[model samples]
Target: MRIILIGFMGVGKTVVGKSLAKNLSIKFIDMDNEIEKRENKIISDIFKESGEEYFRKLENDLLKELVKQDNIIISTGGGIITKQENIDILKQERKVVFLDANVWTIQKNVSKEINKRPLLKQSENIAETIDNLLKKRINKYNDTYNIKIDINDKNINEVVSEILVHIG
Candidate 1:
């Protein structure tokens, strides 16, 4: 079984995916981390040096490679849904789980790790940025998910458990 976790950054895709992979006894592949490994640079640096378009193209190429494996759980980047091609590649034979978090929840979660997120790097108003970005990607998320799990106010353990129950 291949499961792909999709959502905005700081929505606990990495955390939940790790736990879920352990629970399911599958290998866990963090897309962003693999990208950094392959590119020899952090995601923020990729965005800074190469630009979003280049990073997105790289991410899509990597996603195509990652999805072909079996018995793995993938934690995808937040903006992966920006391109329909990414969505199509992700949904080919994987269960795409949308770890839904509202704008306010996203702000709260992202504020703690704002330094790591390239998109929110210079936003003075993180809440507004998250809200606006969510508005742009919400439809894309809705369009390609196999299941949706609202993770607002939920801890990482709880989120993993919820995904397990939903997927099973």
Candidate 2:
């Protein structure tokens, strides 16, 4: 089975995904890294050069290709669930886990990397951006995720434990 981790940029998807994959003895793939590798450019660069529309198209295509693999753990991009088609494609044959954290927590965790995120980089206020974006996408995240793990008061290990419990 493919265990897909979905959430905003700062919710520890990549770190948790790596730990979970190791614990489960499966390959772990971060969709954003995969895109950067394939395009030979960082995600921020992709957004700067080609625009988010183009990058989302690449992300959509990659997700379709990735679900064909077996026993993989996927850490999806923050906006992966923004499109209905993408959500439908993932739900076809995958277990999607949403990692939950408030906008304040997200901003705190992602402050160092805010420059790396295309959408947040354009915002005049990062906290406000995170809040607004989360408000807009929370419903979609809830609708698409099969399992939800609230990591607000949890460490990485704790978060992984919760995910394992739910997955099993």
Candidate 3:
């Protein structure tokens, strides 16, 4: 079985996916890392040099390739759900889990990170941007996911346990 974790930037997809995959004895793949390896460039560089449209196309292609793998836990980028084709491919081939977290939780988590997120870098009002983006993507997330886990105040183990329970 393939499991795909989808959510905003700071929602712990990578952390939780790694733990979950370890526990389940499945291979774990971070889509962003996969993209970086494939393109031989950082995501920020891709956005800066090639633009978001190009990045999105590359993300879509990566998603297609990822869904074809078996017994893998895949953590997707924040903007992956924006494309209907990506959503369709994920829903058709994997157990899609939406890692839901509030704006404050996301902000706190990301604030400590050194890596730059393209969307958050452009925003002066980070909270507002997060809120608006979450609102806009909520329905798409809802439609594509088989399970939605509330990630607020939850540790990686708790989140992984909840996902395993839901998937079973």
Alpha-carbon lDDT, every model: 0.89, 0.91, 0.90
Q: Which stretches of candidate 3 lie over 4 Å from their true place?
A: none
Cα lDDT, model 2, residue 6: 95
Models 1 onward score TM values of 0.96, 0.97, 0.95
- Measured on C-alpha atoms, candidate 1 has an lDDT of 0.89
lDDT of 2 by residue, 1-168 (tens): 789999998999999999999999999999999999999999999999999899999999999998889899999999998888898986775489999999888988998887788888889989989988999999989889889999897899999999988888
Q: Which pairs clash in model 1?
A: none
lDDT of 1 by residue, 1-168 (tens): 999999998888998999999998999999999999999999999999999999999889989888878999999999999988998886675489999998888888777778899989899888888888989999999988988999998998888887778778
Candidate 3: pairs in clash? none
Candidate 3 is scored at a TM of: 0.95
Candidate 2 lDDT: 0.91
The candidate 1 region of ten consecutive residues with least summed lDDT is 86-95
- Rank by lDDT, highest first: 2, 3, 1
Using TM-score as the measure, name the better of candidate 1 and candidate 2. 2
Tens digits of per-residue lDDT for model 3 on 56-168? 99999988887888999999998898988888887785489999999999998888652578777778888898899889988888888888999999999899999999988
Q: What are the per-model numbers of colliding residue pairs?
A: 0, 0, 0
Candidate 2, residue 155: the lDDT equals 96
